[model samples]
Target: MASPILPGSGLGSGLDIGAIVTALVNADKSAKQTQIDAATKTNTLKISGVGSLKSALTAFQTAMNNLGNKTNPAFAGFTATSSKTDILTATSDSTAVAGNYSVVVNKLATGSKIASASFAGGAASAIPSGTLKISQNGTDYNVDIPANATLQTTRDAINKAQGANGISANIVTDSTGASRLVISSSKTGAGSDLSVSGIAGLEIDGTQLMGSSPAAGASGAVNGVAQNAELTIDGLAVTSKSNTVTGAVSGLTLNLVTVSPGTPPTPAIVGVEANTKGLQTSVQAFVDAYNTLKNTIDTLSKATPDEDGKLTVQAAFTGDALPRSMIADIRAQLTAPGAGGPLAVLSQLGVMTDRLTGNLTFDTAAFNKTMAQPGMTGQVQQLFTGTNDTNGLLARMSKAVDPYLKPMDSKSKGLLDQRLDSLIANTKTLTNQQLALDLRVANLTKTLTAKYNAMDLLVGQMKATANNITSFFASLNAQQSAK
Candidate 1:
């Protein structure tokens, strides 16, 4: 006998096999899927929290690093000012000493400028073009001019000649309506005087361009002269070809503005004073950065209080000990006594901490008073930037924080970075588990569907046999009654 053929779902027994299989699969998957979803959400929140903590810690570290550098402008304890800005303006770096100096501006530096003699054809006039020889500061340049070149064309050619010799040319119309070619030097000293030749009809007086007394001209004419800057500092005479004067005083740069000192002889009083305001500003910045880090730690590590006053571990990192330990270490370093100095502790320098929030605050008045004391600025600087001093606040704090922020070696990761990596790995594992469960559910669904379809086909065959038997019996009864 041949095997009976199985009908598809709902065809023979009116039973919905596909729906039954789907319901069973969903029932088996719902519980595991819920757990996976919860785990994934937790991992994602932890990654974000760790990232925020790392960012805050890094910012605080940067502020501490800036305070540790002695050469920074914030540590510069000097300010320089000029009494007569018209005569000169000056600036001083940290190297300057406090003192008053007598200054007199006798003459200002001048650059060389020379003009060609008037041309008969004016600016548009064509001239016999040849190689123009231009010299400045002992360097010479040869500029080739095409034939029938106008003053404008000759000027353009001179400028196009590329060389180290600083020389420039231009065509200018004098007050008398005559156009002349003017050549000047790029530098401002006596050695930068310019000279030009090679135009057949043009002549430039070399002596006049050198700033020496020029011979009388037949009519109105202007000549260029080169001269050096003359000045006196503290009764010492000084001469330079440029207006910017340096090296006369250690760490002082004088920018000469004019030769005439203002009325009443305003001699600039340049001196070094304690940069108390700058130091105070930097200290405040450090305090603010520390507060930011502290707040981040509190948010990440602290639990929320319920309505009934019970503590709940509702935060992402509430159960984690790393953030709490890191913050505790930082607080200990901040409160400890600093290295031996006049300002031995942060409180002495007007930096204090809040009892509740564990954040730092700055007292401007106290800092100003401490900085005003003699020799206290150097001591304050040493407290933060001291060399490997265990008691130094910033030094100790940096040492403690460095391990967490920086990696130990090429193969090792930072504390937070490592935590995030672990969370990511766990997330991948959860995903793989979910995929495995789904595959098992799919296979079970296939098997169950086939069995249900076979059962329905067998039931349909039994019903057909019963109907045929009943029909034969009815036919027999009807024939018997007729007899």
Candidate 2:
């Protein structure tokens, strides 16, 4: 900012030129300044209003997506149940057919466990110096034993070596203070059993047990063999390498936990059916979400006076049509029929809208009752999620709101973004105009100060001339009086 030029006071006329110049400059700049400030404030409020509306719409879109997700049970999926969950558990997806099957778990799949021969020196016993090979499923994992290595060191070496197929080793001491090296494998199956056979003092093949000495009878033996899980679904034999079984039924996964226990071996009844409760909850949540969005829009576009009518607060978007138009489009989608079906509308699914307030109300009891009807749950889910060819209700809502709520880009822009862009541009122009106004005010002040200084100088010169003439006349009169 350039400093203000101090105007000179008139010497002869005794006029305050600085005050006059200041008043004139203020009067000249005030109107333009008020106009710029008002425009800038209005534009800022409009930007803030559009930003808030866009955020609310984004939250609504997220809530809608949750209902349309296939894994969330709202999208016409299925739920599976086992009567004896302790013996078996089940899970199903949307493609699963509704049915009941008798599941008999004869045996659960198991991994391999082997205990090595007892060492006389316990952990301190010297292990044979050689390559120790642990084999499982045709993969031999070798552990090189250093010279003077003890049973403890051998176990450490086995653990440190990367066990290709999930191998672990530990030492178990017997009653006579003898340390037994026990090794295990996580691979499960009949043919995938584990065996150890590279060194003499540590040789095991399910039955071989290495004792204290080389010639002594070995005490090591296989504790458990890798075996496949045996189960029967509806008397149809099913064998699995792992307890967690899949593909035994269409779109169903069975987790075989334990064998069925009874005098005649009781079977667990596994059933698969549509998940209605989850879908109902999702639908209600969507209604609540819509209501929340509507409330925000109402607040932003509100045009009302206070109770006292003395002070009225101007809303952020009082005259803005963008918020209203965006809400209208979304409401139209919500009211539109969803494809050709008996359950094509939201009202049929118990989602109703208020006429006066534009808020949504969910009738959970009505929804549950409709879901209780035979095969109506799937139809309602389809109404929200839609099929391959037809657009669903949620899909339609996306189409309606995406144009306004999507992120701004080069090719296209959201409505809120466009409004904000124009507001920012206006603010930028106002800022430039304000600068120009200030420059003009400074120039005017400078010019007026110069003119006032020049006039004051001329008045001082004229007063000096008048004083000279008066002095000359007084001198002549004094001379005349002396004569």
Candidate 3:
């Protein structure tokens, strides 16, 4: 619909043809292009809004899931403490019962450490080559030593032999600058004692490896002695190869620090008790998470008030029913009575809703009073973690919100995810249409330019013919006047 493009109009019809053509083309495409731009902006806003809503919903679901988790200690509510922390300390899990334990550590477990006789050659001392047979707790390991191997090489070979050989070797330089191969048991216990043999020139003085000796096994020298940990728990004797003791107490692991070596057995008292403060903190976390979710939903679904006392609406989902309906469903689920339980409703557990704002508010004093009641903790747990037949408030709410916030899939795409996908598809379609429109506009511009250029050429030809006729008439007039 655009007019044809023209050259400098003053040389022909004295009209601005280029400006006229641009105006006509713009008028033809303005409405359709505006619609396309507006649609793209709207779809983009909708996608962003839906993404935010999904995030908020997922956070709320996580809070609900945590509260409903039966394995969480906060729900069962227990903590452990040690009276004599210097001697021992312990931690308790949910299964730990409230009780007092008397623990007496007689001796701490020790690992065996033995050293070979001092070599005057220091670390470079060449000992007998071949394999040294080492045994720990009846398990034998062969450490291969190369010909003329030094003390350091022998140590590295012994260490390289893996598995329950139960020994690690290292070289130690004494005060006289004499290096000795010191081998120690990898584990602590009386069963981890080490014995060595098969050094062709070396003498085994009991557990000590010497370059020369009075006689083999004649010197009964004890370089290191392995011992077990002895302890008493609740008047019962318990022994362990390591200081870390388990199975002595249910759901309690005692880390023995030092031995109590006196008579009359002054036992350390370890106590396990219910942790009410931890439970309160967890409940507060749930409340905070719920409030944050509520605020996000409200902001995304409602109009805002302007400084001029007018309500200016710009929410992408302002007219969307899904967000509002989801919020309503959540609120309804929160206030409903749980199935056949003492903590039938959230109000009974001290969680109340603000009527005006529809936000949840937790009352600490009331919650404490409820928890203090006999067997109320169990009832409270039941309210949040009911069976499938009798779904708890949190469980029900999570189920309701899940369908809307879950990811897109062939079998089951969530409501918000589906909406976003549709918007994207529409936007893509609009983009294709816009591209086609651009091609049409380009073709129209070319046609109009050619048309206008032909008109300008015709006008110039007419002007040239008129000029020639006028010149011819002037020449004739001049000749006649001269005659």
- Which number leads on TM-score? 2
The regions of model 1 sitting more than 4 angstroms off are 1-9, 12-16, 68-71, 75-268, 303-314, 336-338, 365-378, 387-396, 466-483
Q: Give the alpha carbon lDDT tens digit for every residue of 1-483 in model 3.
A: 333444546356556767666667778778988998888887888888888998899888988787766444445445667888889888764346678999999988887666666677889888788779876777777888789788887888888884345678787775678766667776887767666778853333334323233222232224447788999998899999988887788857788999865687588999977666776777777778778988998888787778786768567788789888888878777767665566788777678889998788888899898888765655555566554434766688788787797755668788887888898899899889889778777777777766776776788788899989999999999999999
Candidate 1: residue 73 Cα off by (Å): 3.3
TM-score of each: 0.56, 0.61, 0.58
Worst 10 residues of 3 by lDDT: 212-221
Index of the highest-lDDT prediction? 2
Which of 1 and 2 is the better model by lDDT? 2
Residue 221 C-alpha lDDT in model 2: 42
As for candidate 3, its clashing pairs are none
Ranking by TM-score: 2, 3, 1
Better of 1 and 3 by lDDT: 3
TM-score of 3: 0.58
